[model samples]
Target: MPGRAPAAPRCAALVGPYLSGKTALLESLLFATGAISRKGNAKEGTTVSDSSPEAKARKMSVEMSTASADYLGETWTFIDCPGSVELAQEARNALLVCDVAVVVAEPVVDKALTLGPLFKFLDDNQIPHILFINKMDQAEHTVREILEALQAVSSRPLVLRQVPIRVPGKDGDDVTGYVDLISERAYKYHPGQESDLIKMPEEILPREQEARTAMLEKLADFDDHLMEELLSDAVPPKEEIYQLLSKDLADDLIVPVMLGAAEKDAGVHRLLKALRHDVPGPEVVAKRLGLDGKDASAVIFKTSNQQHSGKLSLARIFGGKIADGATLNGQRIAGVLKMKGHAGEKVPAGNPGEVVALGRLEQAKTGDVLTASGKTPSGYKWPDPLRPLFALAIDVENRNDEVKLTAALAKLCEDDPSLSFGHDPDTHELLLYGQGEVHLNIAFDRLKNRFNLPVKHRRPSISYRETIRGQLKQHARFKRQSGGHGQFADVHVEIWPVQRGTGFEFHDRVVGGSVPRTFIGSVEEGIRDYLVRGPLGFPVVDVAAALFDGQYHSVDSSDMAFKTAARMAMQEAMPKCNPVLLEPIYAVEVAAPNEFTARCHNLITGRRGQILNFGAKDGWPGWDMVEALLPQSELHDMIIELRSLTLGVGNFAYRFDHLQELTGRLADKVVEQRQAAAAH
Candidate 1:
């Protein structure tokens, strides 16, 4: 018989809170599968997953790293997401491409305290996931103690799959000897030699026999054979137990807890073997994507710019084979490689159970579908990041770097969704916003280190507008004589105030064509262009201008002539109209801890905020959302104080409310600082 068709490549996302050993686990998995010569330590900056210079300097992952392993004749693609909430969207992207998730959780009481919201996120995604309590070697507590802590934060049933046989040390400390629940065998780790598995140590076997029986009873509840074997004194075959556990794990029926020292590879080889066998393959994930197993469709999970190769679209092949020279979305692509971190070999086979990179795919983006062009493929949409803190305004000092900066930032943003940069129209600042301060800092570092785009970060300037306090009539005449038909245009215009947000308005109030009809429109264009640089170095707004009178030379009064006159007239009239700075105000919604109400109230009042309402909120304990209209000028540094008062748990979101008047030194500062920046 012909070989059975392979299943879809299975995908699993690795995510957890900050510093939860996610990187270490990937390192251990890669090395144990013989994919690498030696495992790299995250602290030593030699880890395969976080090999970027930014990761090395910060000692944390700023973006998601995609890698694959082939073991037991099965291929598994895994995503290692940044642990910080700022970059947690990396995990979200990982989930989009995967059928299952591995939520790496530290099995410690204090560490498990913040897993409530994260648990809800995973549960909501409907991605069957297992909880791995990593770093078991250094943890002071036992596996059971960590399980109970997780049980308290989440309502999910904490099932025991493996219990570490603790061996006491001389200082009254304990080290894990073997997993007692998996089998009755005992494991002894020798310092220099490989581990030894022997017949059950008679003394310790009895000590864990009761717990072993309880664990088997739970497993038997799902597998009928185990239940029958339990009563009949016929022990269930180990293969049958593994099958049931694997099925339930894939189905999200029950989560199996596994323990291992991610650094030492203790219990790691067995864990990865099980994952390769049990984790849903790409074929299965394609089913989850609502695809029939023919033709290729894969989500672009990552995009990286390589030094030698321009752009590498690292993706998982969901259905069908992606061979060399296969057309994607009607575009013929070149080269595909099965990646093991930074090193990958050109592989012709892009099978269902594989994680490969389609190099130099021009049409691909982070979430783009790689299907035959014009085919509607079923896939989940990318999640929008909720970035609360904005930081890092980057622009290059070198003129050449400035030319490359936009393209470089685009590639970086394509790689990591949490990283974003653009120019603010009102402030004229190239603003970069991210999940937090550290996040954008790392992004800037990557831009400089990886692509050699040297950039710097500074505070984003507050965006404000300029409007008139009262109407004023001003006339400007431009008469120049240099050659034949010298430029000459004279105009009289009236300026009036509109509602704060009515924007800019222009009307033709002339008769008999005092100014030629052609020049009339040119006058309005000049006024709008002048608005970008207003009297106070801001965008001019909420003012109406009308052409009441003008004189023009038919030959001399060209569009350029009227444009120059219009600029001069507006410049003269703005200061006389009682020009005032219009600063942006945000409609803020602050969900803060109740005890910080007084502090928040005082803080907002100090920032010129007008509170609309304040009341209690549901679902969150001791929290209230204070709705207010606050000036945007007051918001740049507002989060720092808000977080300080709330002990780092409070959060808020806001949008543009309106533009209001700016008086006093705040108005003076806007002009003074703007002039200073222009000078620089």
Candidate 2:
């Protein structure tokens, strides 16, 4: 067993808010592990992760990228995920298969609130994570102040492992080194080189002791033995402290806070060492995923379309080994690849806990669990994609490429579960839905750049229905006489308003058979056709029509004649009925931080929304839910406005509640717009 191959590799995902320097931190990690010879700067578009054309153009990560490293002869994979809230689906999905997540953040107090959603997700899933405070040299706040600000958003206890050492001779107070609280040892940082251990400064002794005591006390709360030792005034050993910290982190009971400046590669070496020692291995993560470690099974978490090679499915093997040409989910593995950024190398096999890209697995998709026997694992719960909050109506610019565009869009959705597209039944426009405007923009960019499908994007149309405000009855006869044949049919019908949401109804009251039995169905059909577009230039709803009296000529009164007569009667009656426009009202529920509740209420009311209720949102603490009835037309840009007011964390879900009458100037304007559109 001494010379046996190392166990399956462990994976770590880097996640945080936008512009938090996660990509730079990933580069530092790869360099520290000796995976890359030179570090790439994110701003210059030289990083291996953000290599896509869209990412380079925007200088931000729009999707997840995988890179593997071998540190100390053991394989470890680091997945760099996008930090933009609009692109959070990539982070969420990547975090699922990772053993631990590094939540990169700046040393700012107010910025802590932006991490609430990410913290809540990690805690809810019971995933182990650590906080890495980046850009320490440029920090504007003290470490203690930053930690206090972050603790408010997370449920887990925060354990500070290191305290920064300020260099005295700098133009301003700057962090040039750190003191390890656990070991009580100090070191001076050297950029792009190994840090030198230095004598513990005499002035900072009291501060280090205070921080160490606080960290120990937080850990003692969960350990009875440690608590007893602390109560007895006994000092715990360094090994015991580290073991407890690792155990607590793996259990999701605590989060260890580390410091680093990724741009200079300072403090990154220590961070890498910490990860190599404390991160969970394949066995622990496999058990957490509810999979037996003996079987050869894997779950596909990402899919990529390569220009030279076709489709590649990146999956994490949970058990046993998957070799080249192995069949899983009834599809043969055409190849096995080991990926580092956009470059991939062919590998003979993928073992448990390793992330590999299986070549040409066309049938496989994200969130799919596959086994060598082609049977899926039972009771495995995958994370559901978040509901789309933004939409755009889009079409191919070149009509000849419409079919190609459709095929490419399908592939895009398959790659990103959060991206979806459909044809609006009423508007007849192809609507693409996503998390936010930026999310949709990236989707369209991919259409043009990746698939070469030029597209035109615009806002979608609103659905408005019309109904009658008053009732009337009129009679008309369809009479046409030619030299040889004649078309003559007469009918009497009663039209009246119905309750809202009752929809269209047709009735027959011809007891004397004035309208023949065979012609009754045709009469109803004609009335239904007339309702499709009423005099108000919209679909008719909440109305009824009854055929009370009608006469048909025996010679020419066929179904066609009766149908034409019924159409004439409805056309003569509806204008007298006083038609009115009805706009859809939606029941909306908005969720936001407590501080933003008032702003949300104002947004709803400004859009003519009626407040129903407000209360604390269930399950999410320090958050409130506000319920209101809003017009559908007012909701098109509601998500954009809500996010701007709530630090990009607020969101809402809505459904059609009822149709309200649109009258006065608004109704007149709607009718005019409808007529103009119809003319076009």
Per-residue accuracy of model 1 over 351-470 as CA lDDT, tens digit each: 765668887887677777677654755544455655646665667877777768888888777777767778876556787777677667777777777778777678777777888888
**TM-score (all chains, Cα) for each model:** 0.80, 0.97
Model 1 segments beyond 4 Å from truth?
A: 1-9, 66-70, 113-118, 141-145, 152-156, 164-172, 177-247, 273-278, 372-374, 378-391, 473-493, 507-530, 546-573, 588-630, 634-653, 678-680
Root-mean-square deviation (CA) per prediction: 5.3, 2.1
Q: Write the per-residue lDDT of candidate 2 for residues 1-680, one digit (tens) a residue.
A: 01233445889999999988999998988888888999997779899899888899899999999999987678888999998888888998888888999999999998888989999999888789999999998898899899999998888998999999987555678898999988889988988876789999888898899999999999999999999999999999988898899889999999999998999988888887777777787666667666665553887889987556789999988877889999888999999998888789999998777899999999989988888777665656787898888898998999999888888888998899999999988778999999999999998898888888879999887789988878877787998888876888898998999999999899898888888889889999989888889998888899999998988888977777888888888888888888888999999999999999999999999999999999999988889999999998899888999999998899899888999988899889888988998899
Candidate 2 clashing pairs, residues 3+ apart or interchain: none
- Give the candidate number with the greatest lDDT: 2
